[model samples]
Target: MKTTLTSLVAALVLAGCASVGTVDPAQLPQAPAAYKAQSANGAAALTASWWQPFADPVLDDLVARAMAANTSVQAAANRLAQARAALGGAEASRLPQVGLAAGAGRSSTPGQPVPQPATQYNAGLSLAYELDLGGRLLHERNAAALDVLSREQLLADARLLVQANVARGYLALRALDAEREIVRGTVAAYGETLSLTEKRARAGDVADLDLARVRAELAANEAEALALDRRRLELETALAVLLGEPASNFRLAPTAWATALPAVPAGLPSELLQRRPDLAAARSQLQAAQARVGVAQAAWWPSLSLTAQGGGVSNELSNLLRSGAGTWGVGLLAALPIFDGGRREAGVNTAKAQLDGSAIAFREQFLLALKDVEDQLGALTLLQQQGEANARAVSAASQALKLSDTRYRNGLVSQLELLDARRSELANKRAALQVRSAQYQATVGLIRALGGGWSSDAGVKLAGV
Candidate 1:
């Protein structure tokens, strides 16, 4: 009766020895039904080639090159390979281990040596299998697998970020191109005006002050054109770095902006949460932490292993494998630490703390994902409205410039008035271009926030704790 009672208590102790973790994801906030931003039902769906929707063949090529050569993308892939290797090691540990041993030694009793030194030859095949009574191996393997998954998602995230950055940099560079064109065009027009003003002043048809003002305006516009070129060069150098090429030898020629601006459709919020690689990575890390916590707790329990050895020993090497000289043995090992200061408890506590940290990190990543999508959505919606308004402003300013120029030449308006009209026209045109550029960037941003691309069926199931 006492033996039965003791066995029951031991069984109970082992059953409750280990756990995944204390995190209850159910207690965390849930994903909303739909996004709180403007969305279209007729928008094109997302594809694996996220940048292709821009419709710029050049952008498509750049993204492909960066994916293949970008340093950050390469680094992430390397980390994933390492994690896979670790997972293989963990899996190997779950199987039986076999080893072969061989040795030859010479020995002699100081005064009792018969002929010479005695030679001993021994060889053995040994096998060991640990029974997962404490579930340590299982938890360790689980943790390693989760780590591999986490690495995969992290790699995805790295690629997504690089892709987004390239699109952003390229779009901004193109915007600069468009802006530079406008500045140069304005400068040329101002040059013509300055020439006419000089002629009028020499013929006594206009004041010298008017000619001086035109010259000042021409110089200022020329300076602005030069400034735009300098900015363009800076952008090109940075893009070269993104493509994993040295800035010194890399150059991106100013090309016509033919990229399409497709409206991003808002999909189900649940789908968004699942498709985000960063969120998936955070979830995998959290699950791995929970598995590690179980592994740490398992340290407090006894480990049971079965071992077997078959061998032969003989003074003559030739007879080492003979039946008469053969030997065999088997054993079952159970180990429980009597004492190790407070290390085991400390390890368990550390694991629990890590689990807690991972849970918080997962929640933070989830919330951030939502915020990112919302930010881009809001920006795109407002930019669309702003672009319409800017276009009207540019139109009005252009008309005002034409009137001012005609009146100034007809001697009905001052030179200052003409200059002011030119300034307003230039500013309004630049503002419109900036708005267009922002709309492109925000569209890309929205795509990235929606997990680098959109797909109706994209979903990632988080590992249960």
Candidate 2:
């Protein structure tokens, strides 16, 4: 009998190991060799802290603060902790459970002898464990471990997104500041032009119509400046919220614009699978789903469990300590499903459907990641060209405004022509500011799309904690 039992245990162990399913990495879709929209000059590798390239200390501080205090990031961290705890519980389920019990009770029977009441006292230790002959427990534990990893990746992704949002907000605020300054300068220039036109009109060298035009131009420039101020206030308030502060209590002083554009390297697309935290999370989820499928499949087999209890019982409390009163027993229980009204089949089908959904989600995430990088690359390339052209236009407009001013003073051109030149110069300068703003926005966008740098192994290291 002993030899037969040993052989049966060994066979079950081998069969359990053989029954576990495997997932092939090659079964997943492949990435392209190169990005279609990557620029020739975008060969510089990105660093872990991609925002540092902008050389803005305030921006760096804002991003750090947001990561630490943002509500969304905090929520993600909490979810990660929950996943870790769940994994601990799943692992514990796979091990033997030992419990101690002690109790005292009194009972009476109506049809018993004269001493019908009796007192009972008991103390015991109990042990129970699943044999895991079908690998069900192991598969569940594996799935839970993968779930923890998925939550970790999700937390990292949240941090990445928060950092990107802070950078974008800060850069936009700075761009608005720069644009406001340009408008202010234009308003001042228009004021001086109005003064000169009024003097010319008083000296009978200019008509009343010319004076009215100058006044109208001044009013328009002033209105534009006011509009810019309103926008700046709105942007400042929004940025304060991103910093996790009340808008009324937060303020950012006007400062020099940092429009430095960082070059991002277009690495092999396959590397994205590792570098992108969202993709990493998706892959982890897929692994967990695959493990759950195995668990469901294992349900078709029988479950084996072992239980044991050792204790002492007696009518007298002192007698309970005596070895003669001791009681001990062991048991081996096997539960085989004969008929469950198709419950097992439904469970297997559900697990398979979930596995299929996870697989598709992972593929979709990969494709979206590729699209993000390509879109940013295209924006960066086109914005660079636009910036160069805007610079040239600003310079030419300035020269034309100067020539028109001199011609109007000499009566060689009408006041309308001079006003037109001024408007053109201002428009060109404002357009140039917009182009610079777009370039900064695109640069930050590219950094975000590239998974906030190439630090593929960068993650929340909570191992010791």
**Highest lDDT scorer:** 1
Among all windows of 10 consecutive residues in model 2, the one with the lowest summed lDDT is: 456-465
Best by TM-score: 1
Tens digit of per-residue lDDT, candidate 1, span 286-400: 8899889889888877778999999999999999999988999999998776468878778888999998889888888888888888898889878888999999999999999
| Backbone clash tally (model 2) | 0
lDDT of 2 at 359: 80
lDDT of 2 by residue, 265-379 (tens): 5453535534677878888888898888878878766788999999999888999979987999999999865557878768877987898788889888878878887787788
The CA lDDT at 455 in model 1 is 70
lDDT of each: 0.86, 0.80
